[model samples]
Target: MTKSLQKSQSSPSLHPTRRFYWDTESLGVVGLFTALSKVVSLMVALLGGGMNPFTLFLKNGIATALLVVLVARVRKFGTLALYVLVGQIVSFLIAGGGMSMLLPSFLVAALASDALIAACGGYRRIGAVLAGVALYDLLGRAISLGYSFLHARENMAMVMVAGVFIVLGYLGCLVIGLPCGAKFVKELRHAGIIREV
Candidate 1:
């Protein structure tokens, strides 16, 4: 091969280490979030309605926001998407596969989150984080609702009620999760856990 071609192939851009740090950080953060989600799942199971649409919204929103902060700290694109897709799979397995049907929705949410973050120019901006969280929740919930409606196991009225609750949850994420995430990020920066961009 020509020297120029060889040099280009061996460049840092082609090196795995170029992403090793951010990849490891993303994995660690995803693992932590997945574990926490499982615990929340357990609580939901034990408490019956605790994981209802409204509560699930609050739970997932907070988790997503925190994840956004961590991903932003790494300053890497696609980290949030990687976290959501992989994290959902792992979490699904750990939960005994009961929610396997929602995998596609999770993947969609991840892709949307990635696009939203990229559009906002990265996670360092609160707008990016908020948009990612909102899109994830909206798209994921919409898919879940559509699945339920198509299956028709539940009555239309019940499904509509659930949909309303889900919408409420999305709003909760925007109202509560947004400011809380901003504060959390600020705290992390102050504690040196998150470096300022």
Candidate 2:
């Protein structure tokens, strides 16, 4: 190759470390599931008359977890975890929270879930995803408890409710998230983001 061409080619298009962050292949599937989760959640919320946005929370959490799982299928869980964190923050703004004191507690939950799943080894089929959902609940409740203790906005009962909601959301996730994770991995493999085992 000509020296000019070689130089142009040699200049990296991205930081070598960052290539995994933008997994376009997985993003496609994540996009699809996001829409589905949102639609289903909205309908459920409108119909169930549940309190404290139970359906909406599950929908958003499951979507977030699925997106992150898709990322983890092809990239490091830590990198994907950051995406999850940023996504929650962005979703908060989009949902009308629009910035305020204290970053969303969901950010903390996402990191915790990602760490647990990473510890289990990135996307080992379905077991790893269950670990992720369970961790999401565990960490989310932890945050609610901390808030209850520090801010006194809620008492033990309220904190316990938060845990209950997390559990409820996770159960919903299990119904959807596990299959989605497997489908996400399958898509990434088909799209060549991850190699088939």
* Residue lDDT tens for model 2, 47-103: 766545556455745664555455455444654355554545555665655332335
The pairs that clash in candidate 1 are: none
For candidate 1, the 10 contiguous residues with the lowest summed lDDT are: 42-51
Taking all chains together, each candidate's TM-score versus the true structure is: 0.73, 0.56
| lDDT, candidate 2, at 64 | 47
lDDT of each: 0.69, 0.59
Give the top-scoring candidate (lDDT). 1
TM-score of 2: 0.56
User: What is candidate 1's lDDT per residue for 64-149, written digit by digit as tens?
Assistant: 56655655566666666666666667757775565567777777677878788879876777677767766776787788788668
